[model samples]
Target chain A: MTKAKVYHDGAVSGARRAVDAVMTVLLAALCIVWIYPVFLILINSLKAETAISTTSVFELPTAASFVGLGNYIYGITKLNFLSSFCYSLIITVTSVVLILLCCSMCGWYITRVPGIFSQAMYLLCVFSMVVPFQMVMFTLSKTADSLRLNTPFNIAIIYLGFGAGLAVFMFTGFMKSVPIAVEEAAMIDGCNALQIFFRIVFPILKPTMISTAILETMWVWNDYLLPTLVLDIKKYRTIPMAIQYFRGSYGKVEMGPMMACIMITVLPIIIMYLFCQKYIIEGVIAGAVKG
Target chain B: MEKAIKKYWPVFLLPTFAAFVIGFIWPFLWGIYLSFHKFVTVSKTTFVGLDNYFSVFSDPTFVSAFWFTAKFTIVSTILINVLAFALALMLTRGLKGTNVFRTVFFLPNLIGGIVLGYIWQILLNGILTNLGLPLLALDAKYGFWGLIILMCWQQIGYMMIIYIAGLQNVPGDLIEAASIDGATSMQTLFKVKLPMVMPSVTICTFLTLTNSFKLFDQNLSLTGGEPAKASQMLALNIYDTIFSRSGAQWKGIGQAKAVIFFLLVVAIALVQLYFTRRKEVQQ
Candidate 1:
């Protein structure tokens, strides 16, 4: 292994090293391209509303164009973006938590018990992942209203339903590889099934749970149409809904405050991602490959 | 273990199963049923077989939207995978600052589609204005290309991460063996590396295909089927059918279109997977 590795890396000639240097520069340039649009949004958020024009958009914000925290304040107070932020946080947290708990438990049942019902449940969860949201948008909205699931807290119940397919699929896939010996030993030790699951299986499933929570949180937080259809917008709005409503509701778009709201929506996620880069990336890889 | 665990089925499975029925199963079955009935609300309905489906075929906007989305899916899928694979290949070459570059590239994937749409709408239109071209919303072709560009920007890094993972798993000895056999770099890439990454190709294509087809929010924010709805996609078409218009017939037709849209996605996805899976080599 070391010989092969040395041939691939240490054996590289000076010319190859030069080529590597040039390639690194090219990759660095592409990184700038990836970041430019987000940077554009950030600078636009700081610019005065009137200063924003199609012609001057790409230019850096000038001293005259800059408005320090002005747009953020306007977005919070005037457009009531803070309430939308709170609602988004509440719904995402509750939904992700509910999905993790219920789906992980269901996955344990499906994996531990071999039976016809368990097989059917597993297949149904798998099938649900493929069905598009548009297929049931209208009917689901009506169902939510009928069931009184249109409120912020109750909507997590709705998310648990839609999110079950992915969450259960992930958990079950992870669980099948886990040995049954631990649970069997627990069962022999005068532990009932509930106690065994809560104490034994749940701890073993922590990595899968965290990854599932991240994936579901990403979806529920950014989801726009589901909330718009199910929730009464007059009462509750997610961050995406608020941004869309902010744009179309005004006769002329409030570009500055709108951009500020976008910044608020994106910053927390970026911060979380940068902090937990390893887990988030691993979660994504595990999800795509495993599924 | 199986018998003992089965005794606690209600405790373990009941909550998720119940929510699944409420959230997905019932709404899905009812939505299909609604497609056949002419009703403003679920309470009042008249059974009308095949009438709404026929109207769906005749509607100019719906027909055009289908073609537009099909074309968009193909172009974006091919571009996204190719560019992402290229980036992955470059980044895996023991380059300096690869981590920083990877983080930056993957940044946009974490942002929501709606936010992505607004960011690009401003930047793309500004570039168009500078170049003395018509706005993106004004022309059908511009709207098509604009969406393709935006999607590639957001999804390439995501697909790149997948591709990178796949590429790193390729046995290094295989590549060295190819080099020892006097194979050219291109030959080694095609014969050795490419086949090894077929699994990633299947995954990336599946993802890009479904995502582009099911896309709604970005299509809504960007262009929004402007220039008289010339650039509308299938999802946006289904949405506008029910909500943008107010009538019993339109709702029925919208439901019908949605059913068709779902089947199209499922069929295409299955076919893509079948062919791609056949090509994937087992390790």
Candidate 2:
């Protein structure tokens, strides 16, 4: 058998295998280090505030004081969870849907019909992408106030504008890979433009659509900036802004419940990521790698 | 030609064009114009020529913030891309459970900047307490590094995914040829693989550099430039100047800064593109 080899070579391979094993273990350990803070927050979130403050965050709850979900319940109630929760949900879903529709239509159009104007429009959009959001925040906010879009719908419009550049870029790139033959086939079959898009093109574009949707959803869901500027009323505060209030009220070091609040805030994103993880990963790789 | 234009163009192009102009183009133009005007509100802006530019240039805090952002973009861009590329190499070695590892590493990224900022603030300050220093300090260096660390952790996996894809697309024959020619793994990487991955590196570097410069939410949540405004980035400084400082009414100044910021980012991005594109070998 080839297994019967030279001793020196065998020893060299053995040492190499050992080195690989050690590196693998080290990588695993580093990943654990990377993610353990999340676990720390999660478990500590379940404990009562007193237990959290007194006990080491690493320790388990005692049988006498195994309070189940108390921290979450109390934290939510104290933080006005219901209103902020609704606000965040409404804003995020609405913005995402609007963004997707606008981006897809624009993406399909600009890519399919190549011209000087569309090219200029596309460059303008690209420029918008690199332009720092803060640069435009003052002007946009003032404009929004002037237009009186300070309502939820207005916030959604701002998001649509902000999100369109990247989404259109992705959609256009993906659309390039889809040949003109498909659309022409539909057209020859007497399909109207709307019919052709809905029946033929959209289904083919599902993967990109899903990728765009997942990415945009995560972005709008967790976004704190636009919402902060637009929705000034205390009643309209989203979860991130609500958490800001909590931070201010509690001052610097309120570990237990504040951590619980953070866990609550991140819950939706974590949940969404769990479901759309693969598509999100694929989208990021495709988009960034190609650039 | 007229008939074809009527038949095909509008069907495919109208919706996107209308949306792009209304949603992005108009606002972007308005944003540029608003920088040169002074007003308590958007509609009320009055053009004031180069006065805003003069004020923005002279402001000490703005100047410091600009330097801070430059330093940040430089260091973090190098650190994030280098580390991410290394991790990409390790993870792409046909290892078991690479997908799971990628997912774990990427989770931080999916979490928003603000959320990640707060989470890391708690986690980091928890450690810093043992060192007898608060997370926010006088020099802002702690917050600066903390941000760099947070940015690196959150961004590495995203960049790694790109790097992995680039590594995969690298011509296998070239790698094999290098190895056959008695090249070590390091030599193969530096001499062969890196040149091929220049496109990916270029894209990743440009993105990280711009992202670092533009970061605001994380900077706000993490430090807010505490202890005498040491950690404020250019974006945050502009934000504070426009909004937080009452009667600063320095819309013109803020706009000047924005204009300058835009020019700098565009210039850097262009230079980076040129340098990287020149080195990109066509397969």
Candidate 3:
């Protein structure tokens, strides 16, 4: 019986090892496939415009085809890539900060003060989440125009409104989990409502706040439709909008410069992601779980 | 405390309330009103009752777009969830370099939809050309599958993270008990592991369902509903109808389509939540 058991154990262990080896190889191959498309663009971004189209885009840039920063220069000077990048940065930062501050305060009030009005406000914010942007695109554009919200700086206000649903929802959900005694104790010590919120409650809500900030930043940064409709496109463009217009313009697309601009646009986000990857992953999971 | 908080309610809530009114509330109400009126612009309007809604039903393109979006959403949501769940299972097995792999997979999700669409457009076109097949723009089927692939690429990682969280929370004692009772690997997975991960499954499904339904940027930049608008999803269809159409009546018709689309999403989401929430086992 002992010998038979030993043989069976050996067989199972061998099979497990084989499965592990196969899975590792399979995952490695998939990783390559996932990364290849982006890599292809990066390499092609350096080639001369003539070579970009004449040869397969998969081919490496040769000595003859290498222009070396030529595309970057053209993208910045002619394609308005720099201005769009600056606009994207400004809008994302401003919108994220505004949403975080405004929604957190609103979320706290509604959660702490129980009443018909607060309940209705909370429900409305939740309801807004499911409403598709296309449902309001036309009227929204018109509204933005009338309100003079056609600039990047002012566009943050629009983001706050549209973003309030998710932000307030997440914030209130997190707030409910917080211990009420902490706030009450602070209040008893004579800290004003604003002081207690900013000095005490806000610190405890840091994780959720970070998560909210990251979520809003990602949305506002990558958002193409809202800004495209709300902003004066002639005067200001987000990175995605600029990329679309550049590719959509008449005649043959300057693939080299376009790819360069894409690289420039994607690099900063990737770097930020790498630095705070843990928080981003945590934030996404937290946000989804609450959502 | 209540009085203190109430006295400062204007400070606490007004910014968000004011913005929400401007951003969502007014636009939402205006959109519904516009659906009942004929207008070249917001200011130019004439009340037309149910005429615009009637025109939406008659537009074959809008109807076809609805069906197309439905099929795409079903396929992509299933693909993304299943693959993401499988990946989560594999990565949670104490594997080497799992974190690195997770990060790599999640990278695509960070890229914007428009950029994702254009990148996939070029790549798919290249591969299809090499394979002697029609480019993505030339064939509706290719666009459909291309969008699915792009969506899975972007979403699977996100869902995987959620699934991973769910998977890690599965009580180890339960798995050990099942194994000690001689439960097979397949049996443990199906009977034990899956039941515990249903919450993540619910969240992932809700996300994928809504996202695939509301997809616009990718649909626009990828194929732009080429080949006579065969592949246009509802959102893109509504956009084209509102903006690209010349007649003033098309705007209201598009608005009606938007209302219908909104209702369809809300109904589906509620039903999904109802069913999925029922299946979740309370810890």
Candidate 4:
């Protein structure tokens, strides 16, 4: 190549490098800003109550203000944090497992069976997707209470109904993409529908199952309004409801423990997220694309 | 196969169908019925016809909340999609440590909305106090922007993931053809990349639109519609009207508002999906 052509190429590549550098710096700055809130809570949780409220939150905790594990202890003991954590865990797991099993089966049935009833069922699940929880919150709670389905353990049934829409929709979409030849062959072997599903189809659906489980787990774990309204609040409180009630009961005086509780609530989810980051990202994409 | 499945319907579908009927269908039908009647609890109800609907329309707080939620939805939806798309573009540029940045940004979305709101409340209040400004709860405008900031933080990462997926799926041949045709980078982005990612745009828009309308936990914990309820959204308004209010009339009115809210969200989501889907290019 001529010298001029080589010089032109160098300049163009230099400009591209400049743009890349600028973007890296900008994204790095934004990440810090994005994580600042969680960091702020973490540091303040270690500070004394007076420091959290009286001093500017930007300051690092001093020897005088540091309370060590005092706030965590208070949160666990006085604030019922342990019970709420367990409740959140139990509720989220049960609801997700129930949603996966039921919705996958329902999705499989509707996809394979071509009839008016199946069509209507699929349509109803799609319709339920758009119905805001507010529309059914009040009456649903009352209904749950009347039927004795208001306990934390049993509320998974309620979530199954509420969450069935998206779960069924997603599962059905994936099911349609699954080749029918496999199922046909399994059927030809004299395998029952249940056996075929458990042995062949269920294993094939592992990816979508992970997607649905992650999506439902996030929703059931973080959900506040439904549990607040439906579950007997006196007897049961999820992490979000528990935190809100904790704040209300303590008012402003217990800011330290509140921060501690917030950290406690957030840490485990973050840890889980770090472990399953791939599935979470893929699950989101799968959910959004199908949704 | 059909006969076998039909025979096993009790095992395959009964549990879900039963739970759905009890959980969603019954409550939904009852809610629609309750919207037209006056009742405090469930048992005692008097037919009120259109009176509850009329009350919802006439209530000034409900009207203001409708506007607030509308404005908030529009602003946040636009901000989130744009920023998310931009970040998606940046992260897809073969940058080093892009994964780490993506993880950092996405961390917020994993946290619950209520916790996010309270965390932001403390942070924003501190900043405002340092600047000698009003607290987030003390003014509707601050509360509005505070909620916006919180939402943008929580959602941009999620929308970015979807957009990244969309961006990655864009055919390399199309981009190569554009560059070969001497298209400027700006032209290649706007004319080539943007149009190809319309599917992602459609999904993100739908998710953001519905989420912004149905938002409650964040609204409750962030502002609680303080300063005389100026910042209340539709969901929070319906909530307060139902649980916090007394008397039979308010309950009916709340149900009416909920039905209206449901219709509004459905209409908007449908329209959005239609328009965006039309723009999606067939691959």
Candidate 5:
């Protein structure tokens, strides 16, 4: 796959090796550039509020400038970080779980049963995926409020509604590719459709289930606009909403605590990526390819 | 099994369908209906004909927002795909730490847009200030370029990963045959590699196009369309029109804008789908 070969004669392998070496260094530098802003936030988070001024932004925290965990402490207390984290956690987990379970069942049913009803449902789900949130935001929030789905606990149903399209699409795509021979055997063995699905087909769906879960988690966790619109912000706040509130009220931003809040908001997702990167990447690929 | 399972529809399909009705179908139809009416609230809405759309079209900020979003989408999509493809080409080469490079590049994508926006704001504002230039929000041009830069950084890794997968699937034997036929690298890339990765191109371009058009969170946090809303994209423009204003007229206009935006997306998605299907037929 190396293009260096096409650039050189038969005896230029050493030159190609050097070219590869140089390219490696260039990529490494680009990687540093890629990761620099986050690193900058980390350093500035530890700096004293006074020392994190624009001129001194890139400088490492000196003894006089360092505040250790002070900004984190301030951010936790003032930004209301912990409760927001709890809210975000609840909303994301509940939404992802609900979407995966309901959509998987729905996906299985629609594919297995052939009818106009199934086809229409499938088309609607697919159509909803491309409709931008703006189209639905005004009425969605109003509907959620009226239905009392505006709370953190019940908002997952809304997530279920919004997320069903992609989940069902991916699920049905995989479901169609799975042969029905085993399912038929289970049917012959006196297993009802429910039993075979729960005991047999569900297990076969673990890979897709995992990927779907990851995609949903990444979305619902970091989502800002939906929760803000759907939930009564006075009563509930997700991490992104809280972050918006941190600097949202006034443009006279509080740099120190804002930095802490940014770090807090990003930390868990970064840790999760480090641990489950392969799954996350693959899941993203699956999600993207669905369109 | 199909016969038996069909009887159990209530157990499996009912819940999702119910939620889908409540969550998507109801809102979608209601949104479309609301777009044409002037409403302070749903109960207070009055049928306004095309009055809301008239307001939307006449508003200069909304008009500029459409053009700005169009320009931003075009520039960012081109830049992101080109750079991402280059990075994919580089990273796909057998090299030490390729995995590490790929990991680092892909990390920012997992982080939320609002967080990514603030991170860049801090860095960009700090640098601009140190250099005695206008901060990101202070000038529309700076805000424009700031968004361009941020979008590139955030999306390149994601598009690169897709492009890598595409490149990897381009069948090694074809490449070998090209080289054996005395084809240079550029020729191989344009004729063989590029044609083969058309699927990836289609997906990547589709994603980047729609995402760039539909962008909200990053644009909101990064610039908030400051300097008199000169930098607001269509999404943010719709948001501010509905949320920031105190009157029913703006809400109706916002809803109208949303409808227009939705139609635009559906049209583009359909066109892309048509091209992809045609390609599949040829292949």
Candidate 6:
């Protein structure tokens, strides 16, 4: 597969090597720039409050250096880490399952129905992707407060609505690539629509489901705005909201522990992304380029 | 059985339809209605005509935020696409270690906006602290640039993945044809490779535009319109109007701004789609 080298002259290989070296050096420099800030925060998080404030963030830690998880331990206690983690996990897991089920069903129906309405509804879902969360913030919050459904369950319901559009969009795209003959064969075997979806079609959508799960899990888990508005109670604070409150309540900035808290919240997202990145990219390409 | 299925279509669709109506449709309709009303709550809404829209236009802060957002969107979109396309091209050369490099670069995109914002804030603050300008005291220009950098870093990897997909699907025969016709490397890239990637380009551009405009969590966590709200984007401005500020007077104004924001987004997106879809080939 290698192309015949026009650059086979004596100086060509040398020049090519030089160019490659320069590109590698430049890319390495950019990588440092990209990744060093993260290192700065991680280092600062280990130091004492005074050390963080007084010394350069780049400074090496001395004998006083080994606070040895004190900052992290304290951050957990201060940020109400257990409560927030639980709350976030509950909301994220529950909402993702619900969104996946409902959006999959809805997507199935939309794709199956040969009507103008289904087409219009599909377009609506795509259009909703661009709707800013702020557009619905006030009315929805006020409506939630008025209906008195601002509890955790109600908040989950709200997430379903907010998530439905994107989920349906993804499901529909993936479903289109699914063969109709399979569905017809399942139908001929006396499979009801529900049975077909749950037993046959749904299993094929495992990858998209995972993609949706990862995407929504990250959004709902780390979501600040929606939870901030709805789950204002201390008992129900999600991790991001708790971190915000912790930051606000400290009055004076405590860089070490705050960064520690931030890292704790960020860890799950980074881990999930690292593992599911291939699926994420495929799902994004399928969902993104179509519309 | 077919008749039964036909009759039950509505039943199957009803749950999702109801939820969509209540959750998305209702709020959107109410937002449009509320934009013309004066009220703290939906129940208290009073028809105030286009007064809210009037105030939104006259507000200096809103104007500045609009311009700031537009400029930020333009710069970040360009930077993200260019960087992503370049990276995609480099990686698609079948080079060793490219997958590892792609994974490393794309890791940042997986982090949530709010977390990325706060992380970058600390890092930028560290650098700025040396220059004797805290993140807080830095001018709107600094905030603007900070956001652009953060957004570019997070988005470049995502756009790269898209461009990579686009590049992979570019038929080798097209490149071979160009080469056989005596096209130079740059000529092949511009005439053959670039044309083939137009679909990806369109999609990537639209994604960048919408994402930049609707940005909220990051804008909130990063600078939060620091240095006197000078860095406020349009979305942040609408949010602050509703929550940070008191009084029902501006609720309608916020809604009005949102409607305007919606129209702007839709119009631009439609135009972009039309332009890009025209360039897409059957293959």
Alpha-carbon lDDT of model 3 = 0.90
Which structure is stronger by TM-score: 5 or 6?
Answer: 5
lDDT comparing candidate 1 with the true structure? 0.90
Q: List model 1 lDDT by residue over A11-118, tens digit each.
A: 555666888799899999888888888899899899999999888888888999999999999999998899999999999999999999999999999888878989
**lDDT (10s digit) by residue, model 2, range B12-117:** 5565555455456666677778777887766566778778888887889998898888899899999999989988887866566777777788888877777677
lDDT of 4 by residue, A204-272 (tens): 899999999999999999999989988877888889998888655643558889899999999999999
Q: In candidate 4 chain A, where is summed lDDT lowest over 10 consecutive residues?
A: A1-10
What CA root-mean-square deviation does each model show from the true structure?
1.6, 3.5, 2.7, 2.5, 1.8, 2.3
Clash pairs, candidate 1, are none
TM-score per model for chain B alone? 0.98, 0.93, 0.98, 0.99, 0.96, 0.96
Q: What is candidate 4's TM-score for chain A?
A: 0.95
Query: Which lDDT tens digits does candidate 3 get at residues A112-162?
Result: 888998898899999999999999888888989898998999989999989
TM-score of chain A of each: 0.96, 0.86, 0.95, 0.95, 0.95, 0.89
Off by over 4 Å in 5: A2-10, B276-283
Poorest stretch of ten by lDDT in candidate 3 chain A:
A1-10
- Check candidate 3 and list the clashing pairs: none
Tens digit of lDDT per residue, candidate 3, span B1-283?
A: 7777888999998999999999999999999999999998777899999999999999999999999999999999999999999999888876678888899889999999999998888788888887779888889999999999999999999999999999998887777777777878799899988888899999999999999999999999999998799999999999999999898789899999999999999999999999998988877
lDDT score of residue A190 within candidate 3: 92
Q: What is candidate 6's TM-score against the reference?
A: 0.94
The Cα RMSD of model 3 versus the native structure comes to 2.7
Give lDDT: candidate 4, residue B128: 88
The Cα error of candidate 4 at residue A34, in Å, is 1.0
Q: Write the per-residue lDDT of candidate 2 for residues A99-129, one digit (tens) a residue.
A: 7776776777777767776687678777777
- Candidate 6 residues A1-291, lDDT tens each? 035234245686577567666666666666677777667777777877778753277775566865757789987886567777788888888888888888888887887775787888788887778788888887777766766757666577778877788888888888888878887887898888777778888899898887787677767876888887776665577777766675556478777788787777666666776787677777667665655
